[model samples]
Target: MQFLPVVQRIVADRWPWPRSFPRSLSMVRSLVLGVMSLFGSVAVAADWPGFRGTGDSVATGQYPTKWTATEGIAWTVNLPGYGQSAPVIWGGTVYVTAVDGAQREKGFVLALDAKTGKEQWRHALEPTQKAKWSETVSRAAPTPCADADGVYCFFEGGNLLALTHAGKVRWERSLVRDYGEFQGGHGVGSSPAQTADTLFILIDDRGPSYLLAVEKQTGKTRWKTDREARGGWSSPVVATRNGKPEIIASSAGTIIGYAADSGKPLWKLDNVVGNTIPSASVSGDRILFGGGTSRSKDAPPMGAKGNGCLRLIDADGKPGYESVWSAKLGISNYATPLAYQQVAYFVNQVGIVTAHDLQSGQELFAERIDGPCWASMIGAGDYVYFFGKDGTTSVLKAGKEFEQIASNPLWAAKSKPKSAGNESRPGAGSEYGAGETVYGVAAADGAFFVRTGTRLFRIGQ
Candidate 1:
């Protein structure tokens, strides 16, 4: 272990010096304390219950700044099926959901041994309604939400269910059976947010768009608020505004915040760049919003397009929230923007990253990364982790300037580089769909978890 040498050095270097008996005893006391602390450090790491950890997107512990494919991996387990949903950690197990069959017909949930990467349990789910999604994305794109008692998973086919920590199905429901069909361009990609008593969901579709809060214990709808019937992939985030929690959902024309408990409309910031693909991140009363997609072939080049501005929105309560600052120079494309310390980060689909001041939205630095990232960035201590679509993990030093700490890949040794060789397809990048895809990442206690298309890996545990 990395700490073993440091413990030995501290206990041996200056302990048995030429000293008096009382001084020696004091040194012994310090040595005992040091060893005890070292033992405490060996305890099991923490848990990341949902997307962006606490549904707030703030990673709070010291994580490793450097690692490699073989060097720093604590464990790696192959997933049963392929899904883009990120892995959520709770209790001593990690939970993930994926779609099966060549048609992506089946959806399943898997629980893995957090320490050993062993399959503890697997539940092949029976969909309440058949799912239909575009070939561009998987059927199971929404990430799962995990808590102490159970984990809730949502599939693009309109299935939402709660299962106990031991993999027993507690409650299940189909959104399509209850609320007609999801009329969206990309099926369902929004992951639900879990609160103390409710499971909040953002259903943006062509038929009837609504935000609903479901009782966690029973599969009962608490409240449903209708929205402008439009489709988007952004996940709803629960943020406390003026000491009360509100759920914020971003779409093409509007970004609205609703009362979390009552599902009442609170505020709306309209005429955004639109075509929002990234989830909103909250910092205290300030919420960070980022770039949108034009979705038109005749549209301007993807650089901002009067759209790429990384907007720092401040909650103003009654009169509605105001855009405090907007960094248009460099902004997001697909990956969600991250606010680390006082700096806000945006990673676009083409691998470009920009860091900005949280308050002023002043550009700190603009740099290209190994990305084309779909997974949102997460920061721990002085290092921020970026998961690129090419299975590249670019570790950047968290600061005002650009400093790359290390870069690594998640592909196996025998895997060859696949080319997303066809550019004629819609939204296809030169490198898109050609190689391994890293969909999302999570961090807890001290370990970092990465979810690729077919695998889940725990590093620096």
Candidate 2:
């Protein structure tokens, strides 16, 4: 056999050394194997690094199916202030933002030991200025996004911040100063999306609203695009076209696609109507966009009063463009449409759930779900969970046909007596309500973390 330099040398050296004795390099070999196994374990239990768990809008984990205030609660902690943002879990920490009681716009990004539900750290940020037009209970509604290195938060008043896993401030920026001001009745509700290298924000403000990309490592502005504002609160999502990724966003007037790397507008569909708050969901090559009543000016005179359409954009061209079909389903303004396999599900503010065919805009089935819904529906395996504003969660099968599976109530506990001077504060009318309004629901590690008014409960086993 022709000698292959190193290979032949190694064979000759090993022939006399390993016949009846241990190799000297055996310890080194074991150490190398051990390091690889440790890396594999870390990769397996990946964190929910950002909003909607990995930007595909899929909450993946062995999340709990049935839960109540008392039952299936892994742990319950009384949050310091109030917020509507969902709890973001990363590694072993849980992070959320809230506005405290002194009329101060505070950011409470808490770190809880994911295993024991114990408090780790509470990082607070005093706002430069209090957020405007925020209802007492609805302030700080934007959720936090976390990665292995740090957690990020976006305040309603346009403050964006990054913190280390150990609770240290990494960087901060203000969207209003950097970009412009938002125009919604409520402030910014769109959560930021984090990718491997950049953090994306959908700033649909009143003046010069656009999609922005920032460097995740240093919080520096990477690229910004000033696109037409269709008046939306929907979060931007990353979708792949061909082999490249695109940032897809839906607003009141159009559904546009931008290059994720450069923030360039690729295509636009102007068939969508009304102010949009629902994020688009992608299934295979077809992207689904829905929700929003026609802006007060564009409302139809007859039939259902809202404008809803299921547009299928073909993702196989340089600038693929088309609206497969459009429908007049009156969906809720804030409820995002969810895609499950072949069918698409939508829940409106008035409590109606509609299922539509993915390919065509034909309605498959429609049914009325109890209570008004502001939180988007989440699909967990075979069941789609709908959390209503009135604190009732309705579970249904994810199918072309309608089916109500279970309805769990989170009614408030007995009202506590108010202190003597507490009644004089401004906007304290509903201080002691009878129901826990479910604003956002997130599933992770076999548990459903639900945010009511001031409490965050872990549901399911």
Best by lDDT: 1
**C-alpha lDDT of all candidate models, in order:** 0.68, 0.62
lDDT of 1 by residue, 365-448 (tens): 989987677777877777888877666789898888999978876553544425422111211111122345677787776877
lDDT (tens digit, per residue) of candidate 2 on 1-461: 00011111111100011112334577446534433332222222335555565554456545555555455556655677767777778776777677775554576778776655677888787765464433422366777777666888888667888899898999998876776666553456677765656778887746667888988778898999987654456777766544456777876557788887899888876656543566766554466676555545565444332334433245654666555555556364566667665667777656888887765767898788876666667776777888777767888877777888788755435464254221122222223336456667666676666676566666664
Q: Cα deviation of 49 in candidate 2 (Å)?
A: 3.0
Clash pairs, model 2 backbone:
62-446, 63-446, 332-348, 332-349
TM-score of each: 0.81, 0.80
The CA lDDT at 358 in model 1 is: 75
Quote the positional error of residue 370 for candidate 2 in Å: 2.6
TM-score of 2: 0.80
